[model samples]
Target chain A: MSATVDVAVIGATGAVGEALVQVLEERDFPLKTLHLLGVDEAVGHSVTFRGKNLRVRAADEFDFANVQVAFFVDEADVTRECLEAVRRGGCAVIDLSAGLPAGQAPIVVADVNPQVMASLKAPYWVSSPAAVSVALSCVLAAIAGQVEVTRASVTACLAVSSRDRQGVTELARQTAELLNARAMEPRLFDRQIAFNLLAQVEEPDNSGHGALERRIGNELKTLLTRPQLKVAVTCIQAPVFFGDSLNVSLQTEAAVDIPAVCAALDASPAIEYVEPGDYPTAVGDAVGQDVIYVGRVRGGIEDEREVNLWITSDNVRKGTAVNAVQLAELLIKDHLSKILT
Target chain B: MSATVDVAVIGATGAVGEALVQVLEERDFPLKTLHLLGVDEAVGHSVTFRGKNLRVRAADEFDFANVQVAFFVDEADVTRECLEAVRRGGCAVIDLSAGLPAGQAPIVVADVNPQVMASLKAPYWVSSPAAVSVALSCVLAAIAGQVEVTRASVTACLAVSSRDRQGVTELARQTAELLNARAMEPRLFDRQIAFNLLAQVEEPDNSGHGALERRIGNELKTLLTRPQLKVAVTCIQAPVFFGDSLNVSLQTEAAVDIPAVCAALDASPAIEYVEPGDYPTAVGDAVGQDVIYVGRVRGGIEDEREVNLWITSDNVRKGTAVNAVQLAELLIKDHLSKILT
Candidate 1:
């Protein structure tokens, strides 16, 4: 079969933006023509998609009139600009950036809540949860149905890619400089990222909760459809160049059986459960992985009411880009089924 | 009052061993003769103290008969051998190594447990807890006395210096190779420690808990004096060269006020509480600090019974060497007062 639909990739040069292009091609999504859009300077740069070199177009200059879907994978400000144009042209928007169309947009993780998402109206403005939240909510969605989770506490170690291309470049550059005994200046991040763990994100809003910390908590509630579930989220910048790891503790309403919880996690489509005798590490097992690789599953020593889990996932592929692409697939399938009938 | 005490620093060439020498000099501890001892090869190597170059002697061959105090800072095995010889000679052993006469040793964290330690016997074989446990317990000791702490969950990012001189050197070597796009192998650790987070410690005991993980829990329980306090500890080896950060959550027996807990923490001399508007990071705030830098204190959302704390400290100074030295200071105040009087 030939290509059937046309989609535009906004913010084509970002870490997640670049990953979106790859995920689309790797998943073999039905593409009539892939439109690559970015800033004015990147307009002439080319990205290879399906053996064809597609020249990037400035997002402001391009018309989104007939675009079937537009994936906005840039920073919040740039995404806000793209969202306005995409919405005006009645194009379906899959947002990976923090900027979603302000009001009542459903933050999504495709596998976690597909049925609820399918019921949304056309030209839907969809927001995807952050990487840490997606990985966490996927595992929780499996158990939230089986048991009532009263609270969750997560300490996440994010990869360098979360800052986009600049993040990855800065880590590589600063790391080399430090090893050579040269002084490194912090630019992309607030402090040194060469071989240090940053306790906070780039910006710390009032409550002492950094940007990444706040997002994880908010998104957890949104994805799990539980607005009141207490979540304590601490996002630290790990020195690793790829893969994110989260140490999560969940307190259920009642005592939970360890064996039953493991069985539920194994059944979840979005998570790959690591059985006993085998543990998962990001560099060894989770790099380039498509699922939330979960292991070290057990109950708390004194409190069986609590469940502890160590989860690792590829921050780029499964974190933002791939999830945006997955949501687009769901958007197409659900919308296409209606038009065809 | 010229120098009046004879002290020997075992494992003088290692990280903690080296730091122990520095702490002793900085504190202006009265010394008659400072004997630095390690293996045979390290014996002729000199370290400067108060403008004098003191040469190291072989630890095994050095006579412990006249040594008033000996600090064992090497690996458990080396310290184990030294403990036996030192005990026979009636020398007071302040052990930082795992080896220190394991059976009935009282593990001390100088500031946290001086009262309990003052009553111990002569020639006390006192062991210090790991850095992670020491930091966690310092804060918990404050809260546990005020509020009943049923459980504590900690996720600590450990520095390379926690291992020793070899660990610090290995990380530097590995980081350079990776940045230069060269192949690197794991030697001192079980896996890569340059820019990666290891899933567990070098050795994994049957319960699936790594060496560091098991030690943190055992030490926390011992320090808190609650033999049954349920502590969940996850120790991840970070790529950084110094400083350690821990994300700790405490489940109190009852709902507690956040401000009251902060007041208790502030009252604790060992902890420096960062009030609102300011936070702590490993590299920027904690690298060479003495106190357990605590900030980001908040109540758990939805679950009011849980308390969250973010703590960072110098792994070598506050974690091991400094704590060991403080124990010696305690020993002098407790025992020397009796002799002097």
Candidate 2:
């Protein structure tokens, strides 16, 4: 932790990637140099870091050996392509993409399972869970010691930004066209997402689970260290521009102590617990926040063992960028010396 | 079946009320006279029934005794105020506003529990469940015969129209204002309902359950006749304007038979079972439809006893108007003599 560390951010031009860079600056990371890199489409874009514009370079041409850590914020394919280079350079990898499966790298959420980092050796590789998983896990982790969660059902209403820049542009265009009483074809999404909810963000496999849905479920189990926990997930695309709204219901082994749950949530650094009377919405509360907003907390209508929660999290800021940056902080605090050696 | 029936529709200017009139006309109900009644605000408006303009008269002045049955489609308060008059008028009541408690009037979904109608005595009063309840009950009922549902967790993504015409107008106004970068105050909803997801549709009770959420849970229990079945519901307001989208996960007593479940859903005349891979959306598949569109049907990620489904239903059409009309038809077919006498 003595010397400043050098880091590279892949896919620097996308929404989450840009937010990652901004977070790094805002958090004042101990960085000697910042490498902004992306695929060919993003090569010409420039991102501001520490009040200086850094041009995004071609990721394939960048030398990963120059940096001690690399944040893979690109799509899965790009991450898969650059994994070997980062491993060869002996750089610690914090993947925002679900490129490396759980077996390849343990999924880590800084607020939930930072202790998982202790087992990793040099050139550490960690996978960051999806935004919904990150938000849910943090809240779940805060209260896990009080009650054993038996099962959870989550309905993730994802913002257009979850699909990145193209998604944001399409939503704006579609909404404008519809407002103007003009019919327009949907691009990026399968159907009209301007004022409609797309049931699945992506095409489901033969088993009918959306890719993101399965990923969130798996990530929650891994991050929470409860492999046997039954997690049901449904990821639907919302018309929202920037936040992910989740409707979560959990069943615990015993009756949930309402006061204790609220106390735990309010005490968590990574969560902002909203009171019962007032609730949070994605646009109204979580659009640019660093912490996930949790509200409308209540027990089941009949079963005291059940708990319901509404969570709104900024998909780019808290969900991806902040968590990834936080993971980097943990890496530097505990494993910096190992990586530098 | 014996003779044409006379009917009165209170609150004939609202979205559901108008749709109810259309459905009645489309179904070609055996009708000698149709009475469209409303409050002071609706007194000047007129609804077209069977190709003729029917003026909406003041409901407080209208004699309910003129009609054999009355469809109360106004607010809960209005419905409550008119209940005694309707009862004194000896007019059978189908309360769509949920004004009367289940004890006073049995909540019924035509497709799921038409048998409940047989239990009613003369001047029968029945309550049409909420849109979410009606849609979910129909789907759950179709599969309940095959698998004993031990528990269910539902995320009801409601469209703006659920709030009625005002809600629709407010959403359009908000979206327009936001798009134009004009800051405007939220009208009906607490916050922006244009491009955001509101965690709860209404002010939740002290227990943290929204009124609609609790009602849906109770209605499902009564409709399925599974009083002991555990039902958890979260009702959220989505940006969509017309259809109500529901994400339902059910845990059965035994492992779900996917093929059998599909067969039952397809066989049911009340639902249009969508195959895997292709899903139904609120605007694309369910709006203006008579049947609820069911899609994204699958088993759980790891558990075989779990089944998940996505349902999009026309909240104004199938959820309320169609169900109410069907209930009227049911009453007329069976209790024509009882009512006329």
Candidate 3:
């Protein structure tokens, strides 16, 4: 196995795409050729990866046969046929779209179920859950081994970047305009999200749960493999530009020892547990961090059977791009390199 | 009984104080001489009431004997001895501080237990819970009658104005500076609250629960008079300037009907229910409103005995100032009128 791997990154000019390019450089991804594909409008726009200025080309011209690995990062109109073509060409594709087709691929979080994901034998495509779910799945997996989680409830505060670059730019403009005592109109969200809290991140359905709220629950169930875990999530669009913050509470099958729970969490590789006094916050602790920052472990006043945790993670850096890179690394080492000659 | 009632508003120079002046004007409270008393720094400052301007006098120098009703708006250095002086002068006082003397008077939320509060015969000083507590307490009280709440958990996303005037101004300055790539220091809170979320609104203790968190529980237990009804609160300082948004979860003794719960909420005057798809948000629905905005009602999938709701209210207007004014109205009509000369 001596040939270098060729890679193509679709939607390469977007937020996750930008992060993927940086991660590729930082990790020195083993590649013979790196192709940056974007929309027709971004044809001449260039991105620097490993000190190489590569002009973006339209994805319509991309040849999947040459793409040993492809990253789908933007919410561009990707079709089943396009994905099938990439799959038929033996490309290891990682999707980070709003959602993926049911039973399409082994949906995964790298830290949670890496071994199973690594041993894939066929030309495959996998999908990463939303940023919030990716961060939360790690913590739940870490704790599930030590404590039997009977039920779970999560209140996720998503940052502006969860919507992408335009969301961030709009928040920047609106924040400035509002601070200057000028009225600012909402473009991406239904409410003024610059200096306010939008209670529902997506439209509410008949069940009174927003689309984003339902997605978090669905993805958590899929990742944890506990279909009846009693998951309830409320996604709030906060004003912050980065880091997904969550207030998570879980009811275990039995009473919990506070110190033991903290010890188990500290032992988890993907979790960074801060001491009580220095509580983990979105900007102060979690924005640039790779692992989920967790603190403020609390037990009930009289009953120790329940616990509350505060957690945060960089939604784009770690949640989407870094996880995608890790998954690709696992794929190449286990299966893709075997085909190289 | 026919003469207008004289009232003194002590510490009338804070955020709640500003809202107090406006609510009194809005409600057209029966008044004779509306005395505005402040600390020495605000001595010559004048506040308007019904097109009449009154200069602020030092609260320490004001005669309590002339006070028919007094509302404490600021969290200044209040003392038990000073409070005793007002009680000895036969004045009725309403304190808006954190901890009022136990057994001093009944701690009250106006809409929740108005009849009992109004019927108190003793000349007294009563305390009102914070705005977030005020909003949640009303909803809990309304539902407590229909179903027995075994336990409850709340995640309160408090607005910047929850801190005070400096908080609002700091957010204004920080929002502008952060947009321009300039860092602004935290002046009122423990962290940068503009475009960010502070995990803990108060200092942590042995339990890792912040002071605000503990206060919410302690106050709820006392208000509901159900010391065993488990309560846990996580207070997050959000960037919004006015509304307090909270995610509430409850475990009732029996299964809950979603529509019936919505109907019960709508039947309560203090709660304003928002239908699904039109979920109530902080800036869009709750800010400046008098009622607690409730939306997103959902029952647990596996266990119908549990329920979740999203609520918001103007922490200053209805949370603090409006409740104080309403308490005064009850005091004057049911208790003070019997003692009037």
Candidate 4:
């Protein structure tokens, strides 16, 4: 690993991509040059990074020859395409997508499974979990530690931003129109997103895996190494623009004493436990941070042996970009590049 | 049972009280005369019932004499005081508060366990479940059918209105202010209630049972007739103003079939299934309905035998006043008044 490396961030105009640029700069990652890639529509746009205006280039036209490490922040298809190009160009590709088509050892949250990337072969990819689930999984992994997670259920109060830039804009437009006594129609969401909540996120497949669910399940499996864990999720869309809040219940293999759980959570670097009577974690509280905020820990009813938790995190940060950047930092620290490629 | 009965509704200014008045009129329950009682501030205030302006009388000044039934909708202390007075007046009291002092049966949803009330030999006391839990428990009980509820977990998305009238006003005012670019402060909830979700409702007791949990557990035990059944609950405040939504997971004592559970739910008269892919029930959809709206039924993970469901009901309607009124109607039809007073 060099003191400074050439890095490329794909899907530069998207929400997570924008956060990726900011996170790299905020974390002071040593970068020789930063390449921003997006669709043709965003080609002429420029985002200021480290006091320099970096013009976005179309992913189809971008050259990956000199890019030592590339962060694929686009959709799964685009990411798959870019991974091939970057790998062929002899560059390490960190994919923040569902998974690298089977043979690739895709790195998950470096904190949870940093050792998985030690032998990074070709197409070095790191798949991040869905914004809502990753935060909880990361926090839980940090505190719970190797415990059998039997039953897990999550009810997500998702932000419109989960859809895309258009979703966020639609929320603002609908809210403004509704408040002004104007007729508001649903666009990004199935129903009104102004001062309301909708329960379904992605259309459920017969296999019970929506896009978000698949991502959550796959990423958690990669991070926690438990592929058979039982996870029931109900993702809801709230009127908020950014942070995602999840009410999660976990039935563990062993009894979870609340005090012990609290102590473990308090000691974790990636999680902050808000006291029971303190201001409970909400969307507003998590809008701009990188840490997963966990509070409101309680015992399960039928299984008093299990523990339930309420977790919230900036979906764009800890869920996506910040986590990707954190993985890059771990790779650099572990000096794994000497063994790969 | 008598063909005619005199009834008084205490705490007439609140959400539940308002719904109670509407329920009385909607059912036209053999009322010879109706009296509305409230605190000192609400005295002389008028509430319209069946097109007649009924002036609210002070709880202390309201006459309980000759009243066949008194519905106590105030705080526990207030309900306790009213019950003592009503009992002295030889009138039966259906107390909505937890202050009934333990000996009497806290009649949850009368439809689910009307037998609990039937076994009570005493006059002057009946109780109801908490608004949120009763809605889900009623649905579960209808399906479980005397099967032991081994474990039940509820993640409640409670409306601001659940906090009381002032909470409702605060939510509306703060939301408007937020939309108008005006700064707002938290009042009804521990945090901002406009565009965010707060994960804790009431302060959690040292035992992890908040006010919401205690009420739900008490209600479920009485309704299921399983005094020892365990219930774990996490109640959160959402942006919704009136309806309470719960994502519940439960394991029953019987081998549960998803199709059979769905059939039982469909057959239950007081519940309406909000089908999957249909607009998931929100607070606005349940503001004035009498039936508990349930949807998104799915099988549990690992234990394909367990079930998970999403339930939403107008907390003020089916959860409180409507259910109470429905009980009164059943009592009239069953001639349960032969044992009263």
In angstroms, the error of model 2 at A220 is: 1.4
Better of 2 and 3 by DockQ: 2
**In model 1 chain B, where is the ten-residue run with the lowest total lDDT?**
B199-208
* lDDT, model 4: 0.74
TM-score of 2: 0.97
Q: For model 4, how does the per-residue alpha-carbon lDDT over A189-286 read when each residue is reduced to its tens digit? A: 77777767776777766533356765675556556777777777777788778888888878788877778788878888888777766644556677
Task: Give the clashing residue pairs of candidate 2, or none.
Answer: none
Q: Which candidate should be chosen as best, given DockQ against the real structure?
A: 2
TM-score for each of the candidates: 0.93, 0.97, 0.95, 0.94
Candidate with best TM-score? 2
Q: How do the residues A245-329 of candidate 1 rate in per-residue lDDT, one tens digit apiece? A: 8888788889978888889989887888987546687887788878888888877666778788889998888877778888877
lDDT of 2 by residue, B131-230 (tens): 9989988998888778888899999999999989999999999999999999889999998888899888888787888778877878888888889989
* Residue B12's lDDT in candidate 4: 82
Assess the local accuracy of residue A248 in candidate 1 as a C-alpha lDDT between 0 and 100.
Answer: 83
* Model 2 bad stretches (over 4 Å): A337-341, B337-341
State which candidate, 1 or 4, has the greater TM-score.
4
For each candidate, the DockQ is: 0.54, 0.88, 0.69, 0.49
> How many pairs of residues collide in each model?
0, 0, 0, 2
Tens-digit lDDT string for candidate 2 (A59-127): 888788899889999988999898778778888899998887548788889999899887777768888
Model 1 stretches astray by more than 4 angstroms:
A1-3, A142-148, A254-256, A263-269, A275-278, B1-3, B40-44, B101-103, B142-148, B253-256, B259-268
Pick the winner on DockQ between candidates 1 and 2. 2
RMSD of each: 2.7, 1.6, 2.2, 2.6
**Ranking of predictions according to TM-score:** 2, 3, 4, 1
Candidate 3 lDDT by residue in tens digits, B17-39: 87898898898887877889877
Candidate 4 B-chain TM-score: 0.92
